[model samples]
Structures are given as C-alpha cells and as structure tokens.
Target: MWYLGSWMFPVISAAMWLGMLLGMFIYWEAIGHPIYPSMDRGQTIAYISDVGAYKLKPLFIAGACVTTVFLDLGFLAERWLRHAGRLAPNTSRAQKVLSVIAILFAIAGSAGLILLSNFDTYHYPRLHDAFLLLFIGGYWFSAIFLCAEYQRLGIHYRSHHILRLSFWVKLTFIIVEFVLAVVFASTSYTGKPNVAAVFEWVVALVFTFYVLSFLLDLLPSVRTSHHQPQGWALKAEMEKAHHGGQQPGAPLTNDSAGPNQNRHVAPGDDLEAGAYRGTSMTNGPGYPAEHNDLGRQKRRGIGRLWS
Candidate 1:
C-alpha cells in the first residue's frame, strides 16, 4: 500500500505536467495558424475573439481546462484528507471553517473551467464571462482563504523549512497574480490591454508556475501521509495482512530497523476501515525521526493550499 502511494504521487504529477504542456502547445499552435492572418485585429483577438477559426484552439483549451479540474480537486482532497481522521477537537474552528471553504471554492473553480470551455464566448458571452469569473475568482478566494488558515496555524508542521517556504511562495503568487488580474481587468474600460496577447500569456504563465510549485511539494506530502492509513488506503492495508495469512494484529517491522522497531497492530483497530484512533508507530535511531514522524501531530499541523 505504501508502494501505491509512492507511485501515485509521481503519476498524478506527471499527468498534471502533461496537461499543462499539452494546453500550452495547442494554444500556441492555434495562435500561429489564424485563418484570417491579415485581418487588422487587436491583440485582444486572442483573449476575446478568434475561436473555431483556429481549428485546434478549442480542443486544446477544453482539454487543458478539464485536466486542471482533476489536478485541483485531486490535490486539494489529498491534502485535506491526509489528517481528516486525526483533527483534534481543539483545533481552531475558524481555521477548520476556512479549510472547508477553500475546498468548496476549489471545486467551484473546477466546475467553472468546465463551463467556460463548454460555452464559447462567441455565442454565450455572458455565460462564458460568468464561468471565467468563477474560474479565476473562485481560485483566488480559495487560495487566500487556505493560506490565511495556514498562516494562523502552520508553525507546527514537521517539514518546518519546506512548509514555511511553500506558504510564502503561494502568498507571493496570490499577491502578484491578484495585482496582474486587477490590471488586466482595469484595461477593460479601454476595451483592450496595452498588449492583450502579452498580458494574457503573462497571466497564464504566472498561474502555471504557481501550480508547478505545488507539484514539487505534493509527492513528499503524499508519502508523509502514507505512514498513517486513511480511507480506502486503510482497507487495502488490512486486506494485505489478511491475504498474507496474518491477522490484522500481527506484528510487522522493517527487518533492517532491528527487532526494537517491531510494530504490533493495536487490538480492536481496523474493525472497519478508516476508524479514527491514535496509532502507535515504531521509530529507530537508524531512521531519521522526521521520516517516521507521520503522526497526526504533524500531518494535521497545517493545511497546504496548493503549495
């Protein structure tokens, strides 16, 4: 089961990377092949106009938008559920509420992207704009809410340096992206940005980096959460023991860690998958404590907002 998590992280990351690259490639491909190349069109042509004329444009965009939904939803849920069973009752209500809000916004944002792709601006300008608002604005809200939640309580995460850096990086992305979005929107009064094509590309590029950073931290997080079983993962774990002809309470150990590190399954545990109970894990001097400290204390310390 741990092996599955180790592999899923990379598989998910690769899928996300491919989606972004494919989106960029097709977008650029479409831009390069304008049916009316000589038309005296403003660069906003890329943002507001020019659709089917560029044969593959919609295909690429639709594909990209769909892929991004999975990227956001998958990562957000993984991060949230990492400690879902272990949340302490004393944890701040505000932080917990914000976390829930962040997930709602993220899911909404994903839905918005699908709607934006399905309804072209040419025929459904109003609906397209609405979904665009949901896509961009919803994500902005989700990010800020989640970041603020962490800032109020993230000091306790085990990967101290990495967690701090990730939060700040996300904060930076949000600030700069917000500023650029405002600037882009303000230009609507003039009906066009100074360099519409450049402006559009810049916004997309910034967002791409924002997401890419999350890709880096995502794997370690999944691996960290693997130490404690959750949901279906827990079920798989029990099934493995049962299939091995061992009871769920059978003692297990990393042979290399020596007998001192043997871990005996607690009685009454695993009666049902995903039962929330404090689990005892073994650690040895041979292994870095941090690597084995995948307890609820750290996993539930602070939530990551796509950073």
Candidate 2:
C-alpha cells in the first residue's frame, strides 16, 4: 500500500539514528575516551568527529545521517503528493502553492543538513552554524505547511483519527523544539554551555522519536484502498501460474476462484487485494495519487510535470 511506502524513509531513518548512536558508543569504547551523550561538553555531537582517535566513526555516522535526511525529504514529498494529487485541483490555488513550497523547504533542509554535517564545527564554524539554522528554519516552515495540508485532508476523512493526531503532534513538537532552542541560546549567554548542549541533544532525540512514530501506520490492519492493484490483474497473474490459458478477467464468481477456497462463494468484488499491493505497485515512489478530485485521472506523471 502507498501508506507503507510513505513510511519507508521514516522507519529507515529512525533505525539509522539508533545505529549511529550505538556506533558512537562503540567508537568511544575503542578509543578509551567516552563521549557522553547527555553531558554538556561545550560541543555538539558532530564535533566528536574532529577528535584524533575515533574520527572515522562519528564522521561516517554524520555522513550516513545526512544521506538519511535526504532520503527522508523524498518521503515527505511523497506524502505531500497524496494530498496534492487528491485535493489540490479541487481546492484553492493557495493550498497548492503552499504544498509545493513545503516540498521545496524540505529539500532545502536536507541540503542544509548535508552541509552542516560535512563542514564540521571545528573546520567551518560559521558555515556550520548557518546550515544548522537553515536546517531548523526550513523544516519548521515545511512542517507548518504540511500540517495545513493535513488539515485539508482531515476535513474529508474525519474518521481518520491518525491524521488529526499527527497534525497536533507535529505542532506540539515544533513548539517544544523552538522553546528548547531559546533555552539553548539563553544557556550560552549565561555561561552554561553544558546545559545548552544538553538542550541540543534533547531536541535531536525528540526528533528521532518523532520520526519513529511514522511506523504506526504499518501497525494497523486497516484495509488500505490507497494503492491496491485491481481485482482483474491479480487473477490474471494467478491464472498464468496455473496455466489455465484464461485471459485475465474478473473472478469467476465462485468459491473456487475466490480468495478463500474453503469458504462459500463471495462475490468477486469481495476478494481481498492487500497482499498483492506491495510497495512495488505504487504510482512511482514519490507520486501518491493517480486520480484527482474531479474524477479525472492520470497515470502518475504522464501529465505535465508541474501539474
């Protein structure tokens, strides 16, 4: 289902974060010098790479995280396309513009993260700080717009509790992140770099956990209508396997041709398709809806690129 593909980057990136944290600890053990995650060492996590003994570990981790952020941006764009493709045409032009802007902002944030990671704090403090600010600010703007899109979608699917919950959680997280940022700034002025660093780590950790929640969609056994293959296609593939020499058509309307052979005959239309609608059955990785709100449809990106 498209919902599962939508979670691809979030789940992968969350696991990457966990792996990097573990790698850091292992590297510290090897070097015989600990880099405390919670302690305020007047340095950010990226600064760990500048040290002589275990430079490769943290450096590699930063690079990997940068790659993960880039990939996550694509996932965010894919998620945005769900609404853009479904509702933007019927909705106001302002909403469409906002969605595109949010996608661009996400891309910008990902690029900033790459620069921030590669240009270490020790080597290019000014450049590093600039990209760091870009990363935070760009993502904030992106999230604000994405939440607006969710608001539009939630209006149609009021029964979808998860969409509304995601909206509120994102808003709350953004508020907390900004508050922690202010506290971090104050700590610097108060000569408490340690506390400031701790705030920074808290912000990062909160983001990681926020990302982990993306897997929640996969947990539910909800019948996904989002990206399922047509009933005819599945039957065709099955018939080919059995050498039935039958052209792919709708089910035979008999129990023999239904999903469960042991059960009494259910209509062909009642057959399940979730198992066949894996991520490969998507309308491309980044394009979510093949149908627009007006009942007209395109085969994914067969239409104008901007459209």
The Cα local distance difference test for each model comes to: 0.56, 0.56
Worst 10 residues of 2 by lDDT: 271-280
Per-residue alpha-carbon lDDT of candidate 1 for residues 1-307, written as tens digits (9 for 90 to 100): 4455433433453465456545655665666834334223454235522342245446646554655665565556445544563211114678678777877887787788678767766667678778877878877788787677656545644333544565687788889989887777676446563454446556766766666555433443343443433234444554786767555666554374543355566766562233233323325446654464455445766233212
Model 2 pairs whose backbones collide: none
| Ten contiguous residues minimizing lDDT sum, candidate 1 | 271-280
After superposition, the stretches of candidate 1 with alpha carbons farther than 4 Å from their true spots are: 1-41, 48-54, 84-90, 222-307
Q: What is the Cα-based TM-score of model 1? A: 0.58
lDDT for model 2: 0.56
For candidate 2, lDDT tens digit of each residue in 231-266? Answer: 233334546867556555745444554344455543
